[model samples]
Target: MNAKKHSTLDHALDNYSTADFLLSDHFVNHQLEPTPETALLWETWLAGNPPNRHEWDRAVYLLESIRLGLSHYAGQVISEEAIEALLARIRETNRQYSVPVRSIGRVRWMAAAVVLVLSGLLAYWWHGRHDSESYYAERMAGLQSKYTERVNRSRAVETIVLSDSSVVRLAPGSRISFNPSWDGASRVVYLSGEADFEVTRDIRKPFLVYANEVVTRVLGTQFTVRAFDAEGKVLVNVKSGQVSVSKDDVPEKGNVQDASGLLLLPNQQAVFSRRSEEFSKSIVSEPRVIGVENEMPSFEYDAVPVTRVIGDLEKAYGISILYNREQLKNCELSASLKTETFEEKLRVICTTINADYQKLDGQVVIHGGECR
Candidate 1:
């Protein structure tokens, strides 16, 4: 945390992003258990800081919608009648106003609430439930989805191809599940442990990976998601193309502003801290060439400037390398990097140029004193 963030308690209430507030431990704890002290803190905070009121309301509404959706998703039938009634009344209002129902799904309307009362956080009986409630509620009631599961428990990687020709490299002790017969808007897969996905191109049907509490969305991209039980965190790293990863609690289409987690380009990674419900993003520590086993690129350079070497690497790995060009403009390097990994190449180049490299949000930033 920076000094600005660390001093937020005595500073402005709305200094943080909406996501920071939504995913904070304090907010979630207060939402889940608003004891007298918690209630006092939030109520007093909300009353004093008028600017934060809107964000507070949004956070609450988002949490409620997510709780409801997850309840339905996990086959928990707690307040179906009340929630449905609420949806019905909202739909009726939309009809009166002549509002077109969004073709997206029920999750959209879930953000609507005429009344601003916080829905009680109630636990459910997960005794014998075995299906995604919201996903199957409308479809299964009308016979629209067919699903299957694939698990790899051996000490070797397993390749599983989906009906859409999307390829999955399922790591040992991992499971990748989806409908065997696919006829849906998107190719949805529930993953546990780690798996590398090479999705087939179908912009009409984007691919979605649900791992732990984070949802990774991509269209015809290659990426990797890791959410093993022992890790207690979700990690998403994009190999090529773009990928959007957001927490399940936050609205997928968060308002008109797109205020959520992040959209990662190649070599970017997002890590979700389960305990704090916070997201931390950075460049991948070691990005490799995106290709099959036999198609890795070769790297060779002879007395080349650092710029040329890094440029070749950037093209090979599909990741951005940022640096002060003038500082290292005169630096030269001569090395064969074909056998080295992405990080190895970076280290070699940095050492040769007497420079240092750090992975920033989604790019590698080079730092060095002026080369003599």
Candidate 2:
């Protein structure tokens, strides 16, 4: 023991309350007996001893060196009950803290009591710290898992980077679910509605996307999928690389033609209609950008009757239109009305036909408004 340890031991003796003595004896025996907070306090005091600072630093260095040298001892297994029983024997011997019984056997008995109490406290503190660390680790793991589990409402457009650094752009009113551990036999994702995927190449594990009863399997492909339950259609358009689309029940080997299956190249589209049980492939010259671009024609005014134009207006603007029986036949006009509101377009049409227009509950009416 050096000067710092000697001074520390002297201080320990001066502060020899039962708790201090018990703690000091345990430390001297190389046993842990302090709570984490208490252990921190002991370390703090050791560092603050200015007179013995050099010796304290050297002692701490040696302790670390000894710990590394004793790494093999970590494999030893000991039970808490055995340690407790030993501590009980020590407590019984020193319970009264009476006079010195000067017999060889009596000395040995006292020494055994000291070792037991010291070792028991050390073991208890070590186990407590270890248990506390493990508990925090488990809690952190649970929180990480919760981060990936989510339910989204509304139209949400999001971009996500996968474990392999691939990017996917999810469309509005779409659902996408993936695991945090996005690795294994296959990198899989569940998709509902629409999304565009730009996959990184990992030939070892193919990327799979599941939508409804359809499964798209590919390796390093760029593609867009528009799957809708209400529309009863799944559109798979590949912009680059190869993709394989097969019905859930389709086997690996059969007389299934390319029409029943599709291996799409760049700028190709595969549409599967559930109602028709049909799969169609086409060389898409100009792919319709789903959700981003409107697919319907802007203006249709060639030989269409007035009734047909009004019907188109109602469906496009989500409104109702009523016209007088005689006005309906006389209201025919050749006009283009895209990018115009229900009332604005109706006003134009009413003016052209010399018919008065009225608005009612998001509806356009032309009077003399008859039953028809």
Off by over 4 Å in 2: 1-156, 250-260, 285-372
After aligning candidate 2 to the native by TM-score, how far in Å is the CA of 122 from where it should be? 72
Query: Which candidate achieves the best TM-score against the true structure?
Result: 1
Model 1, span 1-372: residue lDDT tens = 222222223334555444334434456556555575665456445534546667766666556444444445445444656665654554344333332223323532343332222232222222123445332222234432366778898999999988899999999988766877666666777777899999998877778787767788887888999976434357898888888888765322212124377989887899886646779787775577765546544567777777888887777777788998888888887889888878778878888877766665677778783556
* lDDT of each residue in 252-356, candidate 2, tens digit only: 221123424667766567777553456766544333222213644454476455666776665554345787655566456577776654445666676666666
lDDT on C-alpha atoms for all candidate structures: 0.64, 0.53
The C-alpha local distance difference test score for the whole of candidate 2 amounts to 0.53
**Clashing pairs in model 2?**
32-122
Colliding pairs, model 1: 73-133
Overall local distance difference test of candidate 1? 0.64
User: lDDT at 92 for candidate 1?
Assistant: 49
